[model samples]
Target: MKTFCKFLLFITLITLYQCKEEKKTTIIKKKKLDTETSSVPEKKIVKAWDSLNRHNTEAFLTEFGKQNPETKVLIKTDFGNIKLRLYKDTPIHRANFIFLTKIKYFNTTVFYRVAKNFVIQGGNSDEMYTQKERNKYGNYLLKPEFRKNRRHKYGALAAAREWKRNPNKLSSPFEFYMVQKKSGAYHLDNEHTVFGEVISGFRTLEKISKVRVGVDEWPVDDVKMTIEILD
Candidate 1:
């Protein structure tokens, strides 16, 4: 009877130990699973402005234009707000402008280059944020979209290019100039990509053009600008 009782106790201990081991294994697995789930990063939504590579050609621009048919953008500045209507005919340039605006790429930029009585060039500044934003958007250029109808008239919004190295006259993705002179800059009609024109706030353009500038054409006082896509 004593031997049987001992045997029964040993068996119960063995069973209890096995059960405890199984429960511990289950807890470890659950912890590992919870940790793995918590560690997974959320998937980020890719924006059109993200990964703007040179490979994105006319087709991509066309698709983008198709998606966003509305052509207006509001340029907010300390001076005032200017409204611009992008030309559908210049699809590539228009699409590029729209993409930049949608991404808030022009925020905190400045009307850096102001040609007195001629043009007010913007979309750049000496600020660190400006450079950081530019670096975020890859270096890419748009082939000049010079339609016969798109002239560099007063309030004409056109892209600027590096004329020295850019023999092809591809426009700088980040810089644009607005014609502020009463007598239009007709000579630049076919030379630059005039994507949009100011529909309202011509006075603001004029005011920016008249701002005092130093030797390099940079405004003596910074005229910060923020752009938003209206439609």
Candidate 2:
């Protein structure tokens, strides 16, 4: 009877040990399962929206402005670098420039229209890449954000607009210009939206304005430029 009891006790210990080993194995399997599950990439819900039109432009820019809080940009040119500061009050235009810079849109563009002593217009290029980029982004117009105080002072940054048939004076989102006139082109105060001003690099602006241009004011040698946001 004592021998039988000892055998039974041994059997009981063996069963308990097997159960403990099974529990450890189960735990290992669960951990491996969890790791495999975590390794699998989850489906991301991304917005594939197109064409920032009048309906969505304002809302898009408003959100974009909040995301990109950068107020300064550096325009890199063959001539020299021009530092600029975007105004917070002109949120829409400021956001637009910041967005364009972040996307590397200005890298493929050039100082297309340089009116000597007046303004140096840029962000348009002869390369098809420029048009392709514009198409990719959107063919949109910016509503006039004409602040009475934002005059076209020398080194002022403003948007290009069509004055021929545009009664509302909506600004062209793709192109922009900087006033080079020392006296200030105040006549364009209300017509064009002066969204920013050159903080430094007036010399660069001067050099760019002096570049020889054709009858249409397009530079003889394309004034290629790349604009980057400054922290």
Candidate 3:
């Protein structure tokens, strides 16, 4: 009977020890699971597109002017370089252009549309990177900033928009064009926002304007361009 009792006690002790080991193993597994979970990287969140109507125009314009006062930019193209000066009267347009240039948004974009004796449109391309950049920036449109004093004279820098779809004549945030005609495009005065004018590189503008374009008005040979803020 004592042997029987001793054997029973031994069994009880072994059972206790096994239970303790199982508990320890469970704790180790839980700790390992927690460590693995902590090692996983979190995903980055990007801001959604804020429409133009939602923006506080007064505050936006004020902050933009205060931050980006310089009104000059140099457009470097595969053909040649074109220097431009933004108009102070069109503060919003000027600030927006400068902001895009500072961010290198024009890099790898092609002078997609070239109309001889009319205009040379740019600031967009068919490349995936161009679309990616645009997506990264978010979707938004700029309100028209037309001034009587600002006309589409030769080398005039103006924003392009969808006239058919946009009844208000809202300017596109990404696309811009340069007037290449010797005479000003007077018809575009109220239609588009003339933000800046070319101070130099008329020859360069001429060269880009003469590039061959297909049916869609896209340049046959890609005329890529990069922009730099001069002032």
Candidate 4:
């Protein structure tokens, strides 16, 4: 009877050991699955952006800080690095910029428009490649996302337009202008989309804004622009 009881105890011990091992395996599998699931959203985001690389404006819009806070952008120009703070209120414009920077879209574009004592414009150029890329990825019109709190003030970074045909609608998806003077082009309140401001690069902007320009306010020498995110 003692031997029988010992055999029974041994059987119980072995069963408990097997159960413990099974539980450990289950925990390990669960941890791995959680890690993988967390990474899926990130991979999906990149995949979505890549899918929209062709010409989806709304898809491009989703790539920016929707629920996340606003971000700063550093425009490394031929003259100097001009830092700009993007608007948290304007998600579409902010995201558009973030997406553009990630794709190195501004690497070859120039600060083509420079108006002394007024504003400095950038993003579109005579670069055949730029024109072709613009033709490829996006067009030249956004229904001017004008917010009341934001206006065309000094140091305001606003979008540029082609002509006065659409006074209420904004034009130029790529081209943007930076205000340099204090008078403040308030007249442009309803016309252009002001999406950002100069947080640290006003001095650099002043230098670029004062560069020699032709009759069209285009810089005599091309001021090349490259964009990156520091934080």
Scanning candidate 3 in windows of ten residues, the lowest lDDT window is 46-55
Candidate 4: minimum summed lDDT over ten consecutive residues — where?
40-49
In candidate 2, which residue ranges exceed 4 Å CA deviation?
A: 1-51
Candidate 1, residues 32-125: lDDT per residue as tens digits? 9998878667798877646576677566677887897879999998789999999999898998888878777788688999988889999988
**TM-score per model over all chains:** 0.77, 0.78, 0.74, 0.72
Candidate 4: the clashing residue pairs are none
List model 2 lDDT by residue over 8-64, tens digit each. Answer: 999999999999999999999999999887866778875634435556888989988
- The CA-based lDDT of model 4 is what? 0.78
Off by over 4 Å in 3: 1-58
lDDT of each: 0.86, 0.90, 0.83, 0.78
What residue pairs are clashing in model 1?
none
Clashes of 2: 0
Q: 163-202, model 3: which lDDT tens digit per residue?
A: 7889899888789999999998988889999999999999
Q: Is candidate 2 or candidate 4 better by TM-score?
A: 2
Which of candidates 1 and 4 is the stronger one according to TM-score?
Answer: 1
Better of 1 and 3 by TM-score: 1
Higher-TM-score candidate among 2 and 3? 2
| Full ranking by TM-score | 2, 1, 3, 4
Residue 12 error for model 2, in Å?
60
Question: Which candidate order results from sorting by lDDT in descending order?
Answer: 2, 1, 3, 4
